[model samples]
Target chain A: MNVRIDTYQQAVSRILRFDRVQRTAHWANALLFGILMLTALLLYFPGLSGIVGRRALVVNIHVWTGIALPVPLLISLLGPWGARMRRDLRRVNKWTRDEIAWLWALGRRAPRVVDKFNPGQKLNSLFVGGSIVVMLATGIVLKWFQFFPVSWRMGATFVHDVLAFAIFVVVIGHIIFALAHPESMRSMVKGWVTEGWAARHAPAWLREETGEMEEDQSVAHSD
Target chain B: MTTTAKGAPDQKAGVTIAVGRRVFLGMTALGLAGIVFGARLESVLDSGLQRLFPWWPGFRIYSISGSYPMISEAEYRLEISGLVDRPRVFTLADLKAMPSTSFSQEFQCVTGWTVPNVEWEGVKLSDILDEAGVRQGATALSFESYDGADSESLTLYQAQLPDVIVAYRMLGAPVTTEHGGPVRLYVGPMFGYKSLKWLSAIRVVDQVIPGYWEQNGYPLNGWRDGSTGPTDLALTGGVA
Candidate 1:
């Protein structure tokens, strides 16, 4: 009974980390990217293809899923409901000195205050956005191969193949990182995080969000 | 502002960036190995995996619409007309009754991927044109399919290539309906699209009339070697 009360108190102190638009877009990306990966695997591995022989259907699904990859995020960014996501986008695009320092201080655990989105997250989002555009363009050329020159087809195939492998690895890495930072994952999933968790990991953002600061000293932990 | 170099996520950030670097590098490495689809891949993949997984190189069945037109063997007729002394409507049995030419080669698609060693048997297109004697000025053969959407053409010279057959059998069996069967044109030297599936008509024309894919963006002469098809192949495979 005492533990339950403590848990309730902690929940009461939880911060709203992600808005509805942000959560929707994140989950949408997960679902679409999941489907794209599954279809892509079915298309790529010949052994796998034998088990499920309706390649035309699999290919159509993969292609349409790829074409639709950016829709949810694009929709989320366009509407009034996307206001918070837009603000977060600005934060993701901007780089703080500490974010840069955090990137450089790789091997050693150094002292730096964190923001809502770290530089690594920004890089990831950038790659995902850029790759979507590239993959779509190259994918079109692949489907309508007659229009372009053979060399363009070859180059597009090369780039598309390279980007696909890159996207797969990046997605895997993103999942691993998200799982590693369960508090962060919960923030994205439930749109909230425990105040203590945010305070520990993202002190500057916590202070900015809640307007709370320890006047005597920085709450930045020097690991 | 005071959020300066106050501190860092030395634990999560370091691990994240390190993993990020490896992922990027891994992609670069895999990319170096590279990927080439279609017949070009025959060198890299054909020997072992092709035997193990023959269906690895796939064929895309296409028509103007996303579907094919169904014409049973009994209902099918190939009309050979225009600028000819003897224009003939050949039933599947008629074409099969003629002395057949059978050969095995890759059915290469312009989009890449190849169906390899596809055994095709039918009378040579030239033999049919000889039977349906060409008029004085006829210079090209225009082909239309039963679907009425897909069409293709070859010049008089290309039409006479020894390897170009009006195929009735593929894969050692009667060509099935889904594969444009009963009787279809198969031009071995050119891309698979040149072989009109579910063939319905062959019109001998005075000049070239670009077919369906040609009306789109495909080169009218879709040589598998990526050159002027029969012109180059003429030295060996060409017949008068």
Candidate 2:
């Protein structure tokens, strides 16, 4: 029984921070978002419009990209990776007192023991996910505005623009945070961080997976 | 353990049904509220928005030639020739003397802006076609603008569409030169590009002739029904 438990702990410890499926979905969504932003800039800015060669062409690409934004997410949800994502999402949604204290003491000290994703990361993901749905619905209405009354179209356009600006700000903040933490960036790119980095930054998560904590509490406490 | 497993599906099915019913009820309530609110607010709020933020207009001048030809009412004449039993030229006074029809229509642009409820007063193109005696085998009517650079054509059937007219007055007044004056053709159901301004001549033809914008990738039909056409694909270099 002891040998079997030791082997199971080793297997979990060897697992990468992000699996192949998750990384692929993340990159696909990133590419789609880039396409959406570029097309939107081309449409909204008249001075840059000449570079696109034709207005109708860019409009079609923009509409089609907006429609395809959710495809990667939906595809990811069909596999075991989806179940893992749901578990992570549940963890993020329910904040413990320790998390609140961590937020209050941020920059002054290291945060409390966090799981795979901290509260900030969870909030960012949720905002982006919700923004995608809002953008898709508003885009469809605008594209097929003839089917709807003028009032509805007006309302939809207003909402879509406001949400797009908000999402842009959130995305910038997310990128800055990723860049600030080289270990987190490496986990997303290489699908793993050094065991030392995981133990130091995500002690609870490492303990949950490996069923053991590092002996040096000072290392975990330091930012 | 076996009995508990068997009961699980039944409980899951019951939960699914309950959730589905709640979703249905919630959606129905939301939809009803939306319809009621939309109808009540559309007239007042839509107009208010238009007033505050008017980007495009009902009568935006877009002449192919930099300058629009200005013709006096006295000098203006609409010449009808080609594939007609009787070729004729009618002065503005003669066109006004014919039985007139008026209606409000939304002028839609191919670029996706619309000017709503524009009241146009004019005689039907069919009435003028009738007067000129369009000969058998004539499939289309080509329109020339006094502006010299722009022209449009419609099939004989298109010309006969009930609302298509040679509009002389706009909003209960004489159409100014700035807005396709002494006379202009209004292809009511088609995009604004098809409605050639500065009306000069109409010629009956044996085949469909592509208009100015139509030659440059705007749709030939351009009907407001949102039907996909060659131009819609052509704009994307036929990729879509």
After superposition, candidate 1 runs with Cα above 4 Å error: A1-13, A17-190, A193-223, B1-42, B51-54, B228-240
The candidates score, on chain A by TM-score, as follows 0.86, 0.80
Residue-wise C-alpha lDDT for candidate 2, range B32-136, written one tens digit per residue: 344335334444455776776553222435655645578999999999999999999999999999999999987766544456798999999999999999999
Against the true structure, candidate 1 reaches a TM-score of 0.64
lDDT of each: 0.73, 0.69
TM-scores for all candidates: the values are 0.64, 0.51
Candidate 2 per-residue C-alpha lDDT over A76-140 given as tens digits, one digit per residue, 9 for 90 to 100: 86766675554444455544445555556763554445556665675566666666766777677
| Highest DockQ model number | 1
Best by TM-score: 1
The DockQ scores of all candidates, in the order shown, are: 0.13, 0.07
TM-score (chain A) of candidate 1? Answer: 0.86
